[model samples]
Target: MADTLRHYGPAAVAWVLLAYRVSKGRRGAPDPARDTVWLVLLGLSLSLTLLTPAVYAFTGRVSGVPNLARLLGHGSMLVVAWSARTFLWHLNHPITEVQPRTRLHLGFLAATFAAMSVLFVLADTPVDDARFAARYAGDPWVLEYWLVYIAYLTPAFASMAVLGWAYAHMSTAPLLRVGLRLVAIGAFLAIGYNLHKALVFASERFGFSYPPAGHLLIDGVLPMLAHLLVLIGATLPAWGRLVNAPESLAWLSRYRTYQALRPLWRALYAASPHIALTPASPALVELVTVRDLNLRLYRRVIEIRDGRLALMPYLDLDTATAARARAAQAGLSGQALDAAAEAAALHAALHAKALGATAVFGPASHTPGGGDLDSDTVFLRDVARAFHRLERQSHHG
Candidate 1:
């Protein structure tokens, strides 16, 4: 397991770094919480990477991993576990505009995770001490036995149930829905394996030993495989939408929620006629102030990161058409993309109409395929986030 995870440690590290870059650089969300997660994950990655070799050299087995390796691994696991617990707690006990019942459900998840974390620690105590065994009983003062079971098992089962319901109600994007289902199935398999292992362990303590076939489980296999599935599935939404998609699916590709709620802001303005009274025409909509947009609203914001992916808006109509040809040839071939763009133009037009404005324009109108993907300018995303805040406030207030 240690040797096998060598590449994975680096991969995990890369994921954390890449996620941070994407979040801060692309998404422009300078959240310290996100940074902390990144740093901690990175720390784990390094610790794992370094310790794998050290423990391998010291003991040939992880049963007595070196103190440095043990400390690093334990520290990493503790932080990661704590983070998971906190996340669940926050999820269950939302302090914001969350519903009471929903909050209660989240709180249950939090409590469940806390219980699991305790067991996980206790079960794992003296982990590097080969003498330490699940034998006799897990230490008393700390939660032992089934508490860990409750902690680990419940969330897995709960997630499965929740995702099952979501899959039932969800529509269209089969890949994404299927991805979610697979994830749930994977969870079920992992939990089932752990439960079986716990049973085996319990039976051993009680002197009713059965041949431990823990390896017969998907538990050991699922971590790697499930990780792969999550990688493929989670990216399905992004990859299918904007990352590398045909124009037809591109609109459906990214920030669907932002797109849906954006019109409501315009609606708010129309519903209150007095808000537009200062305008030459009460029907005219001004979606944003001039300061909100860069001086070049009509100019494309194109940038490329990591060399291959284009991440900028196209500068001109001709460039957009050219981009479509290039994109289609590169396997992004699609019906919607053939028309290339007019969606952005149409969106601007609709938003204008919604705001009772005669004209509205977006830089996307002048480009092709909603601006070339050759560069990564998340400016459009920034604008969406800006408006998303307003939309949230308007809805909540």
Candidate 2:
């Protein structure tokens, strides 16, 4: 289970995040912060992919260099760390502040990669072992190579944790804040992994034994979890913006409310065809073909109001009073009671209008109480729902 999770989990998360980022990039204007995040995900994906057992073995065999996959994988991790730091820097500073530091960051990254590569070349390990660190433990240049990698990564991970945590608290956007905090926690875990590896290397060098299981935890499990967290964190803010925009939510709400209003509107339109400004479409056709929901909803509300006014001559006070009493007996109060009574009154009025009953009206009863279009829409939605429930109960009873 540990091996499976270690090899596949981070790779899956990183690739998904990278793909998401790429898709978003096609629609958006170039943003340094977003681009840096993309690079971070890309590097993480490559590192995890290269470190997989099959890919590692294939690369080693094809390259005619034992354990060359290790160097490539480590190089990719270096890219991840560097890009993550750049991403954070871009978030915290303007382009003017970030540009000068970019050169210095790249120079350090280049130097570290060069040093690691030189050490890797000097190390005399002809055998390609997936467990390269354990196999070459305490071997002269191998120890130095591992130490160099750790030395470069330790500070990078520490800084990332610090920056991520601090910026998270400073951020106002909820998703971005949460994402930064996750990144911080991931960086902290990565630091622990690095320290554990350093200790393992030191223990092996000093003629002490460390459990083989320790390597599995530090290398596979810890890094896998850390990378997953970081990948999710880096992508979440963008994902949240794409999905949870206020306009999107409002449009969805309006669409649902429009659909819900259909039963009431259909009955009203049937009783008074002139109440409709536009001839009604079949319900399924309307659902599939309708656009400009805001305008359509506005027109529907107006039409329903006109229908109610036209039926007012048939509205009976006795029917509404009876409904109010029955609804009260059913333990409904406040807006719910009002809505139920209103629904009953409208149902009775429609029947009266259909039967050609004599006009018997004073002031219109069951006038929906709302101060604005949105409030009226909400009240009418409740009425529509209550209307359906009353119809179902009558049918079932």
Candidate 3:
């Protein structure tokens, strides 16, 4: 089960991220070419996962090529290496100027892929045996095939280690630095994995016996752990914004509070347009700063309180008492009762004010105010909801 999870977990994550990118369209990447490379990496990882023992068994039977899974895995790894290297190159270099060495790197990758393909085709190995790497370790053809695979892989992993480490230190952004550091670490782990596999096969060919415990750690555990780290590192920049700036989430909440308060504000603003001190811009676009959002929301809360204070002069104690009784009968309690009673009072006051009712002098009760802005926002939102419900109920009556 652990092995299955190790094999499939990264694959599942890769495909999900790929689907998310595709659905989001251009939002996923600033550069289309670079985005395409990332997508290809995701696709290759997903494909390699599906080409595992269970699925490949069926595929092999249908294709009449017993050792087809090895070829598929090799091909997928090659593509992933190419894509990752290209991605890093683009990331490191300025977007305006294409790197001169890019074409040469592409040629090298293409040559590597071609050579691996040729060797796999030429090599004779068992068709149905899933343990192709271990079973054919001593075979001359298998050794050549392994060498071809590792030759490109070793260099690719090493380059990633160097590039990732250098860029991580050079980067100013906290999230980017951390992500690149992870990538560097993962790349080194991958290098270790490749080296271990090479040594295992070489030992078998050279009649040198090595400990099984060390082999298991190098071959079995390392690859899965390395791939998981690499995937996380590669995708970290995309998600780091959410992780780094918790204030962004707070801003979002404030914006939502502003929206929820809209109906109440509009009603109050209609009654007292002078209450608005500042010109309102698009809440989402203009309120980019946390301070701005907080200020805007604060002004809105003040304006609402002012409107409530103004309406209080026209509030009749008899009407409030009757409404409170009716609300109680309607199953309102605590905050809900307070909100309902206030809504009823406000609706009556607005109507009475429209008809110019004489000001009534009575003992005044204050709006609940003790908690921070978040609590205030929630309380006011409930009041607004109750206000709307009262208006709807009155209209239908």
Candidates arranged by TM-score, highest first: 2, 3, 1
Task: Give a tens-digit lDDT track for model 2, residues 159-252.
Answer: 8899999998898776777788889899999988877777776777887877466567567678777888898788888786766744564576
TM of each candidate vs. truth: 0.38, 0.59, 0.57
Model 1 steric clash total: 19
- Candidate 3 Cα errors over 4 Å, as ranges: 28-37, 95-99, 242-397
lDDT of 2 at 317: 83
Ordering by lDDT? 2, 3, 1
Residue 161, candidate 1: Cα error in Å is 5.0
* lDDT of candidates 1 onward, in order: 0.41, 0.84, 0.72
> Candidate 1 vs candidate 2: which has greater TM-score?
2
Candidate No. with top TM-score: 2
Could you tell me how far off, in angstroms, the CA of residue 325 lies in candidate 1 after the best superposition?
Answer: 52
lDDT of 3: 0.72
Clashes by residue pair, model 3: 66-127
Query: Residue 162 error for model 1, in Å?
Result: 4.4
Better of 1 and 2 by lDDT: 2
| TM-score quality measure for candidate 2 | 0.59
Mind giving the per-residue lDDT tens digits that candidate 3 earns over 1-397? 9778766776777776666555656654378344744755474575557466776687688788877776777777766776666667777677555455556766777887788778777777755676666787777766677788888878887887888788877876656666667767887898888777777778878888753666766676787777767776776666657565434545665777877776777677767677779654554654354456678788888898888887778877777778889989988888878777777777788878878788786787766642787677778887788888777787899
